[model samples]
Target: MRSQKLYTSFGILIIFIAIFFLKQNFLGEKYQDEHHYLPTAVFFSKEPIPSLDLLKSYGELNTPVPFILGGWVVSVFGENIQCLRLLTFAVSFALLMIFVWGSPDHSKRFFLCLAGLMIFPNYYLCSVYYYTDIFAMIGVLAGVVAYIRKAHGWGMLFFIGAVASRQYMLAFPAAIVAYECLELLKKGFSVKQFFTGLLTDKTWLPYALAVLSIVPWVLLWKGPAPAAVMTMQYYDSDKLIQYNFGYVIYSSACLAVYYIIPEVLITRNLRYFIDFPKNHPRLFIGYIILIGALITLFPAKQAYNPYFTWPYLGYVDQLFMTIGITGFFKQIVFGLLMLITMMRFFSPYFNLTSCVVLINILLLGKAQLSWDKYSLPMIMVLWFLAMFDNHWLFTASNRKQDKLFYH
Candidate 1:
């Protein structure tokens, strides 16, 4: 049975790889962000090492890691754009391997979940682009997996790398801290006991290190902040709340249409919830009304102009676009069902991951426009937590142990 499952997973992975390869080759350049990085890479390749002044001149808004990686690739492979895409594909493939390997004892369910994640549209879309988001995502996943396996040192290193790749990843360490607090509470520890435990726990040293990693980036930051960077410029509390509420609704619909639905279909769990509405007519009606109101008030529309060129958008945008009210209804239903499944099957991790994703989305709402690129890290983290089948830190049985850790 295990062999069969492994074979099935490998088969799926092969197909996924082939699809991405074809898309990159036939579809042409689908991401515009590459224009920003390609020039930085070329300049860096010529320099002995990237100086802070050089980065500042380029008006590099984000951290220097992606440019450094891109520079190294250009240095070795020359200036072929396809090489950069291949590099992204290789990193993405590594992320898949990490996901498969991180499963609890390499369980079939975990492998199946990873197979579903690989085919997610946003994830695959990013993979074909020469963007830094993939690197940040891989770093975050590596850190999470390392911490889960009780490798504190490696976890700290990976987490630090993640932040360097994308500053927004600071949310991840905060999420880990929150999860740890919940773990303490689940063990019947008082608030005092929890604080004491947190202060003294050697296992938590890595998180502290991860948090401190942000200091260097902040101190050394040289360029003007990009408009895409999260800031408090639009900090009207009431307006912020209103905008974020709408952003969440719209983002949830996108996730449902592009990611959650595919996951449900692949896991064959759609049938499990098919009779829910029939079982509770009033509750079902209430849900429908609530969802309908949200859709009407905060409809999902393109957050930004298409990241691809006009000719490319003509074909690709239509393929990914969700239509009007009818489409919104389908998305809300599938999204709600996916959330229900996640809570039922993976409550503790689900809640923790949701907190991280929600906080990140709210932060993104401060920007002028919402780009799918900004949400990729959060989405990746969500899928990771959703697919994780091990006992969570907050499980009652796990809490009974004096040392609460995932393994």
Candidate 2:
């Protein structure tokens, strides 16, 4: 009974903090993508549903769903940024609730999952203003939550909504597709059986439809996004021909440092990362060769944009720079970590988390720049999937899924 009271007190305090954030947001609104977004939403308020031309009217970088939703908020609530910000907070809160609702394990794992949403860097910050990451993440995540819960029809709609909000969200559905196919193959399905499942599987259809949902927007804009906004985002027809391999390295390193290291330390799963190489020397040699080549040829290039002159790639690079680490030495250290991280996922078996995380990472490789926020879709959902699958987080239970950190 006392523990229950303590939990209630904590919940009340969290509510106060949220209220403080709501008020704090109104005090001083900062700039992110919102400067471009707000104007578009203001125009969209009168229209409510955007015409293709209208979506392209603002120099916004991505899809129109967030603005369309923002427009709806403005239309009903009147033209107040404060209203929109508060509503965005509500949307973020709803996302938390939905995630908690859909969690496979409803024990303390539910509360444990909140840490990722509320406390992860720049995660809760999205709710304070009109930043689209939380909104975008929620859409994809709602679909993902629904998908895992076997609600394919709802999953299809939510995923479509997500892709409508942001094109990068395609990664979720694509990862689902790849993971499902790999699962089938692992279960002794032949190539012929795999091809047959694509036709027969209702589960597969939702992802296919979700992927296809991007087609109309592609046709409307003549590209991944509006051509007008593409220029602003440093994307062009020429960019379609090139890949950002630098991001490939940077993102792989991020998976190691940001995602893997935390879980490893918490679970004390360092042994797997250590022993994997010795057990599989041939794979390690191949990985080392690949990393050596990639690092030599296409090392993580620092973003030159004046807004982000942070000396190197995203968070890890920033940390190293703070500690006076830079240049070739930093590259070698990260390369080794990156090698282990990628190998960790690849070894043992095909992992759903690895597939999704790597797919998100690969998808972001096409992005103009990499930021920690770019990783939120994965971070926001990745830990929950781990928790739900009965992985290392909150490992007090007997309901074990796997012996290792990730299967």
Candidate 3:
């Protein structure tokens, strides 16, 4: 990471490879849902200044920001989806550069972080399409970069853009708010002291602004998201509150597959299985009891999941089912793996990345649907934290915790 040669050369190689397969079926578009969004973007292109009525529909449960921006680009370059996808690839590439440069130092770990992101199924792999996720993630990664630099205003601005790009993006800013609030509680363990601490700092302003950016949408839609596509996801704008406790467990299992599985593969000590019980006996017992209760109550493949036909359980569950694991057995496997995932990464050293992951998971639990790509932001933050070697999960046991990881 110190020298640009390796980084630049790798990026070039990737672009060259993508170009080689640009016209082939290697990266097929069967699952990609550009039809849902391209029309909305086209609408934005023709009507650069959309009216209030137009804003009401708001492009298949999306905010107007990305479509408007995408429309502007498409108008200038013609509606070549391939060209637009190239632009998305460039945006993802820019995010990679930001992560590499915005890291506290240019350690080899920074390069590792870049490599991890490039290979992620949801990151660079999805960049060769005319989708809006790449736009949202840049806002997220850039905001995290601002957090690293302690630039409150920049973080707020970036997060505001993120929220406009995708409503779920509120999680990043909200995590900062939660982390700051928790840090304030650490200063004085009282309600009055915590409230005073919150008011006493300029750190919360940016996140506050970013979170509040959703207020107008909430008011207009009369719910968290647009009503135009609510029914498709088995929701009603009139009554958006659907209490599905099962989703929390299902999403945890997905997190285990996406973040925990990769990390465990990297650090294959086998001590996770052996020492977890020995190190934290009571927690282990409680984990077993809790897993038993949860599996009985809220297993995977929920009735409320609109994507029941879709492989929303993620890769691990799909693999299990493919290999003759299904029903109660699959849920039990998810329960056990999820506990290991939660305990391993978020134990004694819960920091910024931990805050991001927990908050995102909790928020997703309430979402109308869940997918592996929803975990992309969390995975990205984990990689960033890994770059700085900031927590116990990243082999930072001997090193002192970095100040950037506080709370």
Candidate 4:
């Protein structure tokens, strides 16, 4: 009844947002990163597969698959920015649908969250601007969703597609491995059910395909090995390590609070939290940390001073500033939101606020806050969580159905 209407309205809102982007071609921009993909596509009349020499020379570092595909796309569509931008936007939209449909047990709150994700100023702005990163992110999320559902074949396709979209997506594959390993350890080997199949066969298939797929890059690029090594130098960089550590710690702290805190604080009862076991506070937090750190680490470059201009700070601070003029406004808002949500009565509103605050923290710490590239996943995760939380507000006690969701 009320919940269903909320879901429908949210879906409609998503439609409106997509239409808005479609009308303006989002925000058109010059071909970014390497235009090599386009030309390569033209050359092969197929998605350009990376050459062996290219990978060998570059330490097989960073996936070159996306470049190959992008090149092929330009060849098929004719060399034009409009065609490329449309492809990126289409992929992003497709990702949203995949997130919604791919999960079998989604709730009304998930729908609201979906709407929130679509309307994110960051994602909205990026769709207008051309970015390969967004496409790769779509593949990454798709792969994760597929894997979670036991769709191994499709999962590999997505995982490979993601890495090909961007070389750095290796991090996603690595994370998947870790997640799968944990699941395996908990459930134990089950050859009969084929859960073990993922470990023994399907797991390594992508690496093999990736290796074979990237051969073309090495053969073609004849690029400098030093440059490739330099690209990977972040693994050894202290500053990068520090940032990664901070992100890990902060994310873990948030998740611990979300998971450990009794629902009674938010629901005025203990049973709801126990019932809605599918809330996945832990998974949600881990996903955030994994995605956030990868985003920070992989991008070759970042825009200067991108965080100072975020609009949410003013909105958040305004609420807090009813008391005073000076202080870290974002922190004040964050504290207030946490406190309110901690008190069960205002949990629904506060959950949404907490998501926004987390997003802001992510955006603020990073090199840039531009919608052209970053925040696509942040928007998706936030909206998805918000919508799900909304539905949880209605149920007297969490059911098994409520616990199952796309992790």
The number of the candidate with the highest lDDT is: 2
lDDT of 4 by residue, 1-407 (tens): 44554565567558747675666654454544334344433543443554554344433224544445556667777776666666766666677666666543645445445544564455654554445566777876786566555676777787678756655444444544543443444455666545556646566455345424434443454431224443453332233323322232223223223322422243344443343324545544454455444434432112223323333222223333556633443333333333323333222222322433343334334321222223344334333433343332222334433332221
Mind sharing the TM-score for model 1?
0.71
Residue range 224-317, candidate 2, lDDT tens digits:
8777767655566887777877787777787676567777776676776666667778888888998898788877776565444555677677
lDDT digits (tens) for residues 226-301 of candidate 3: 6757766566653356555566677777777766666656655455556667766787788789878888987766
On lDDT, who's better, 2 or 3?
Answer: 2
By TM-score, the best candidate is: 2
As for TM-score, the candidate ahead, 1 or 3, is 3
If both were scored by lDDT, which would come out higher, candidate 1 or candidate 3?
3
> Scored by Cα lDDT, where does model 3 land?
0.70
> How well does candidate 2 score on lDDT at residue 307?
48
Alpha-carbon RMSD, each predicted model:
6.7, 3.9, 3.8, 10.1
User: How many clashing pairs in candidate 2?
Assistant: 0
- Clash pairs, candidate 3, are none
- Give per-residue CA lDDT, model 1, range 290-404, as digits (tens): 6566556665443333332232112122444434324555446534643443332233333465456555655664543444456667666656665554344223333222112
